[model samples]
Target: MPDPAANLASAMAGAYNAGDMERVILLAAQAGDEADEGILALRGLAEQATGRYDHAVETFRQLAHQQPEVSAYWNNLGVACRLRGDADAAEQALSTARSVAPHDAEVLYNLGLVYIQQRRWPLAREILLDAVDCSPGFVEARLQAAYACYVCADNIGQEAMLAGAVNWPAQPAEQALILAAMLSTQGDLDAALHTLARARLPATPEDERLRLRIAAQRAVLYERSNHLDLARQELKLLPLAALDALPDDASQARAEGWRAHAALAMRAGTWADAAALYRRVLALRVDAEARASAAFGLAASCDRLGRHGDAWQALDAAHAAQLEIAREVVPELLAPDSQPLQVAEVDRAAHARWRPLVAPSSRQSPVFVVGFPRSGTTLLEQMLDAHPEFRSMDERAFIHELTERMEQVGQRYPDELANLGGTEVEQLRATYYRMVGRVLPDLGQHRLVDKNPLNMLCLPMIMRLFPQARIVLCLRHPCDVLLSCSMQSFRSPAFMVLCSSLQRLARGYVTAFEQWFRQVEVFAPRVLEWRYESVVEDLDRHLTELAAFLEVADASPMARFADHARTKRFISTPSYAQVTQGIHPGAVNRWHGYREQFEPVLPLLQPMIDRLGYSR
Candidate 1:
């Protein structure tokens, strides 16, 4: 009498080993009544290898159910979910596998994939670190973690992560990619290009795509390196034909090319051209990010042409897209602003603990010039940056990143704060500084001026981190700021989608302003609000006032702010072009031309507008 369970397992494994998964399925069906854990796992593996994804998933589910304590089964389930593009399920299964088998390197690697797919770069870094810890020889996992760090612009950690890889495989293309990434880090973009050139395939049309990617990377690096002509040439090398490819891997390649074209067009001040490119992209990808970006571009072109109605329409679209994405990503944060006080709430509630971070010091706190997007924040930063003692970094988006982390840690409200004792708060503060330290390595005589507009909402946190930090909030007439936001195209999906509508634009401004008002009430004399109109209307008077706030010497170049448009270091913000070309009076009250279209949002904002001394 053949042992039925062993017989079934042997048959399935034999069929799977031979790559005859169809036979394996038949053997599994015959062994249905006799199938044991080994047989069931074998069937699942066979199904997965043959590309019968659903069947594989079902088989894995059943096997995991039958052997609830088997860690490998859960890990296999996670792999299947990942293959089927279910990131949430993959995370759950990988998490379960971790609990069951704490030392599983494969499970950790799979968990890292889920984080990467969800754009949780920091978590991916941590998980990959764990994977390498579990298995020091896991070279692929180390490489991926290094790549994630590179993309997130965490350059300080990248070399350290890459250094841990025990075995880095060197396929031709992969070798070139590694070299390109390394060159990019060192700011040797031309050398990066030379390395990427090695990736070119001699005869395949796909080689064009490889070339385009190389060119795109070169363009980005050159732009950052301030070689504008070289950047333009690299962008020009990207094939337009790639943008219209059929829906295959090549289609995605085309999409990437078109996206880059839209960005370059905006940078080159070819608004209409950028608008057209965005339209083509939105036709293929109808998401908030694409549509909003395109609409913003279109609005900018229309505004430039003095076509107010069209600009209004485009602006409205972009705003709407951004709100929708924000709500989806953080529902509790949007829901009437009331929710369970979790980690986030607790962090906010423990403001008293932050006093130590802000203790008085003769060493002046950094200057944070914040305002609504498309206002004079960037310009102001440039002027301030010209001073020898000020280092202006544009729109670091640090607070926004922290907000995302808060959500991840289930910090819905500050009531969650009571649960976090002094130790936890200290841990949280250390983590915050760690992230900031990576970006702002040198905090010497030069004060760090991070001019991220959205930091308006996180004034409490900013005060905690840099107690001596001076807050310089920029203000423009509601009409101009709203109009600028509507008209200016953006690369970030968050802005493109939500600020598309006049009503939404107005709502966002009101929301941000209300938050700002709350902060001023708490901080009192710590914050200095500047009106954009006043600054431009009397540059010298305002520049002197600003210098005084910073305690800068009277002779600092910032006192000669008009020269800042050319002398300041380059920053990648939406207002880059406007600041570079010197002050333009065009943006002021351009909203008046489209008054009829914007009236719907005016009622909600009328009081603020009036208070700011602007009127219809």
Candidate 2:
């Protein structure tokens, strides 16, 4: 009997006060009810608040469609769309809202968040900055802007952005990650470790997400500083529960922790431990890339353990995984030839392309001591690292990985200076930078000494990347190299690929190294061939010559080579424990101990032995 207009108004008022949605719906739908825009908005807001996302979305979409001038309705619709994972619809709705409400701080903030999800870093940065300008106190906008800087690897921008966020009323989780990142950038390893140790975050809390991130970041920093002890300790503290919470997410904290743990073990020369960690990570997340890495680690471990069969299995797994990944993107890029690729042939092509790239960046006049496994590459690297100014990045596979990625994309050689398009070149360059950046950053003062013997195949690639990169080819008697390689039970892919016969081993080396040397002769004139015998014969003389060639001014450290070797880290190769001790001349001709065993390979290595001028 009551007037319908008054009844509707009373119903809305009661719904607003008591929050009873059924009565409001009934009253609003009654005949003769005076339904207005304000009443509709109230209904929409109530529906949204009560978790009726579908109904609320429909109501807001209709209202916005009917009254295109109402920016708030469109903005609300965008929020609903984004909540429903309809980013495309959300973007359109948000764009419309921005057109009508260009200066609205709330809408700008929302737009910035959408851009963040879309990975439009530049646009996100701009929108976030605009949001901050409109409302300087908006914490979420500033936080997202800081994250954008992180994505760009803009350390300074990250610092400035995070400084602003830290001053805001930040959640504890955010505070932990920001502090960890700042500490890491500044290279305060121990302090960062301690900070991570005391970190306390609430489980089942939103901020806890940031806490998980902080743990992972801190683990990376620890690994970088070569503090394997701390890295392993800290990684164990991460929330495994969070990984379960994100079962569908590939970038889970648990998976990252496994990688960090494996890296720590790798750095600490614990191949078995590293392999175990990699396997655990692969088990949880069967990603191709991770599987390749895991297989490689397992192979390396098995080789170190002198388990030849196990090592081969691991290597085969790695090769299969790598080939599979390569095939996905480039089916035509064939696998490395079954018959061991002649190193010289591969090197010739690699050097021609790589020389120019390496030449300009060879600031420290690096000495690359390369040869087959057990052929004294590690010893050469250690002797080189003994010199104070020459910093040795021992056996880093950055160039190999970089080249493999390039080869996957059909880029043949690094030194040839091919004229690929900007986008194609950019993709290759990005991968290379990422790979190398993983190991070296701001390596200004010291001469870079990379001794990845396997990289002997990609000397041409290295030369192209670092036209200034000096190559130091480490040579030993073929019989000596082969004998040492076979007896040592070497890691797969490195030494095991020679197929166990001293003959195969010698042939593999001859094929690989001959290709490497031939390519160098033509493509690189800055190379210095060093005999392992000469190094052990007169450590100081060889080192001084090396120091001068590498442009390392300080040769006094050569006098303390014994002391220098004692303090170095990550010596896992066969020469590890040996190089860590005083230089002994015993290994120089130890192959004589098994001369009869070396007869078969002796013939295959005759040419290299003659070329390298080694006495039989």
Off by over 4 Å in 2: 1-82, 87-224, 228-278, 285-296, 306-524, 530-541, 550-616
Per-residue lDDT tens digits for candidate 1, residues 1-616, read 8887777778788888888988988888887666777777888887888787787788888877887789899999988988888889888988998999988898898898888788676678778878878887776676666666654445444655655232344424544666566645543455566666656354666666665666766676565545577778877777676545534556444554676676677677787777777666656646564566566666666666667777666666766665564444334444443321112222333554433432434245557778777778888888877777877655666655655565578974333433444565556666755655655567456777878787777665555445567888888888778766666655343444344456656777877776677666655536677887776687778777877777766635764544665443345665655666666776677768877877788889998888667777
For candidate 2, write residues 1-616 as lDDT tens digits. Answer: 8776666676787887787876665555663234676677767777776777787788789889889998999998887777767778878898899999998878887887787666565677777778777877776666676666554434444545555332344345645565655545533455545555555566654445555566677777755654456667667767455555754554545666666666666666787887776667667656555566666666666655556566656656665665444443333324344444324244444333432222245563445666666777877777667775667765665666666566666765553344444455446556655544544665557667778777788765565455566777777777767655554433233233344345555667777866776766766557777887777778778777877877667777766755666565445455655665566676777666566556666777778788889868
Output the number of the TM-score-best candidate: 1
Q: What is the C-alpha RMSD of each candidate to the true structure, in Å?
A: 7.1, 11.0
Error of 2 at 95 (Å): 7.4
Give the lDDT of residue 407 in candidate 2: 65
Worst 10 residues of 2 by lDDT: 350-359
Worst-scoring 10-residue span by lDDT in model 1: 338-347
The count of residue-pair clashes in candidate 1 stands at: 26
Best by lDDT: 1
Query: What is residue 212's positional error in candidate 1, in angstroms?
Result: 3.1
Residue 339, model 2: lDDT of 46
